[model samples]
Target: ARPDVILPESSLLNLDGVQDAKLHPSLGGFQSLYDEGELAIVQNVGYPEQNFSHFRSTDIWMTGADTNELLATGWLGRYLNNQYPNYPAAYPNEDVPDPLAIELGYNLSVAFQGPVSGMGMVVGDPEWFYRLVNNIDAPVPDTQAGDKLRYVRLVTKQSQVYGEVIKNAASKITQQGGYPDTELGEQLKIVARLIAGGLQTRLYMVSLHGFDTHDSQVLNSDHTKGEHANLLATLGDAVRAFRSDLKGLQIEDRVVGATVSEFGRRIISNASLGTDHGAAAPMFIFGKHVEGGILGKNPVIPETPDVEDNLGWEYDFRSVYASLLSGWFCTDSSTLQETINKPHEILPIINPSVCGTTSSYENLYAAESWVRNYPNPVTDVTTIEFKGTGKPIRIDVINAQGQIVETIIRAKVGAGTHQITWDASRLTSGMYYLNYHNGAIHQSNALMKH
Candidate 1:
């Protein structure tokens, strides 16, 4: 059987800008592109307590317990390593060793580095890879036959075998139908082809970089529409295309795709009108098995400037990871907790049983409604607005999965436009929902805490 998972880098799960009418027009056609897919806007997957500014200052990316204790071994890596120990030994020559181990300085990805012969392939530019693999030459032995000649033959044989494997893989991919031209897009296409070809690969890894949108992030004429938008568009197209291609091959149901990033940017716009390093960003999960629609409580950005110039964290990120591990992968919650070195309640697993079923948005009371946030996908303090007859009003921040992170207000007030400020000076950049309750009625609106 093929690997059931596909993980990519730097992906945004639920962006409000992509959903709004005014903002949608700005994103080209990417808006509403994946509205029907199984979408989970995971809030705060990174450590919220740590100061990211200091960490980024030193260029120390991915240093949390979840990242470091795993020793550069990602959750997927650990899974692979556990499943196949001899996997590293399958790379043609015993002397060559697994490239993952070599690249990470002998520390293997937790998912792929296992005890058994874990068969895998690192998909890249086929032409470049072929050129590098086939053009290798080693000095011939001084004598016709000896220890030297035997070693040379062994090396040549291994190279030839691996070369043939690469060529076959590339040829098969070329002959297959439907793939995008972008890097990650093509990589995914290759992944699909491999799966269709019955490669028996259990874990597939690909990446999409260039998400650090520091300057010129707006879509105006003078300033360039940041790279983030283009990257996301490509990602959306690639994923959708991959899904379609999978359907054509009749294996779409067996595959699941996930995306993550190192961290999200601050809530407030920087001097350059761009975002800087901040805590807790969003994560996305897409597949036939995923429980569709928004989940979790949305976090609210205080509409006041904080001393640190950042937004507050509403949801802990580990909850999302726990959901994926326990729900999608069928791993025990306790085991996942131990692996990530953090203990949080496991979110309700998103399985086929719950797919397509609509869950109530946490604050769905009927009667008076209040809206304290506007222009979601907010770049600064969001103004919380309220409406309805005089009643006690309470505002709460919830993540995508319907988990409440913080309560902004919890008191009765006269019906009118009372403003609550969300200064996002301490939060991670991600999508969130705002819920307002006035005892008798409830209203909820989607907001982006980026």
Candidate 2:
């Protein structure tokens, strides 16, 4: 069977002030934010050995586990548990007066699943939980049944205490105006209020559904008016409003936000006029301190797209996670390795002027071996230098499609600092990756040539 060469009509077009990109019409707010130097996009973000199933892929992303590995705890959960070892024993104290994480929903997300239990609170309504706490009656009789009852009481009592803390924090500030009256907007509005109220929560999670557009993604008459468009509109408007509120409270510089999804849609459309599950997609990061620009080269579209084909990943998704941990939180290399459970390259997503460079990056690859290239965004030629033990070294230059375009070095190099002059004049101006491996030390880095 042959596939059709039909292309889906979209309102996506290049907008003013946005560099090297096209955006849907509903994403005007995001476009404006980018123009103001407060937003950046990382294209082709995905992991190796991607799973296509919704549940399994989502689980892999939530747990931050390799595709073949199964983890009981989540990425953030492990980090939080490590940071606050004695959590829930005597939490909400003066030293740590608020929850470690908060999800604006009724059920705790698996991303907060710790080894013992969920680490974050799921707050739907504080008053409801407060009333439930007050409704607890007299103590039960001294028996096995009483023991279970007491445990339940303790859990509810903890919830009540957290409810009080949330109430106090939320009462400290009112949200600024201009938030859309949509679900995402309301959820983000609450988050803004909590942050403004002086809640010291380090992480917050909120979701906007309806991205699983397998059928009728767009209207037959108008490609711009449909499920996907509505979702983008809600997202862009809410995020812009959230940013304005944060600026109003003068906490814009203190917070950063990024979007994630399990997978992207296939390049080819189906008979239902919708897209099926696909591969790598773009992820956006926005904040006052974000280095505003596109991170990687755009995904390459084939001459004739196939139904079973998918986009290749340029940047491993974990690299972005590692970058945020190191650049934003100033996490140590040891802790960063423990958190992600692997070594991935760190992209320059944060503005070094605001957050400063991480001293932990050199140590992230290995204690004995570390590599870096000079004159980034190079012009014709650049220097590639690295330190390593006496071992066979292999360095491959990879393109945006995850293809190894050149193998610059593949020979045994003695221990100590080494340098290689790479003439990139023959290579086109775009984002490329340097994959270096020597003995047990292996790492990846991004390179840009102007």
Best by TM-score: 2
Each model's RMSD to truth, in Å? 11.7, 8.2
| True lDDT of residue 239, candidate 1 | 78
Global lDDT of model 2: 0.76
- For model 1 the local lDDT of residue 323 reads 57
Best candidate per lDDT, number? 2
Global Cα lDDT for candidate 1: 0.52
Stretches of candidate 1 above 4 Å error?
Answer: 1-34, 51-73, 85-121, 124-126, 129-177, 219-224, 333-338, 352-450
lDDT of 2 by residue, 1-450 (tens): 113213243556555565557887779888888888888898888765668899998888888898789989888888888888867788878899888998877888788888888888886643343344345345688999998998897787665667777778766765466789887787787788788888899999988888888877777776776788889899999999999988988889888999989988887788776788877889999999987878666765555545655566756777788777777878777887888897767777787665555545533443333566889878899999976578788887766445667998988888789898989999876666676766434555677767
- Tell me the TM-score of each prediction against the true structure: 0.58, 0.76
Q: Give per-candidate clash totals.
A: 65, 0
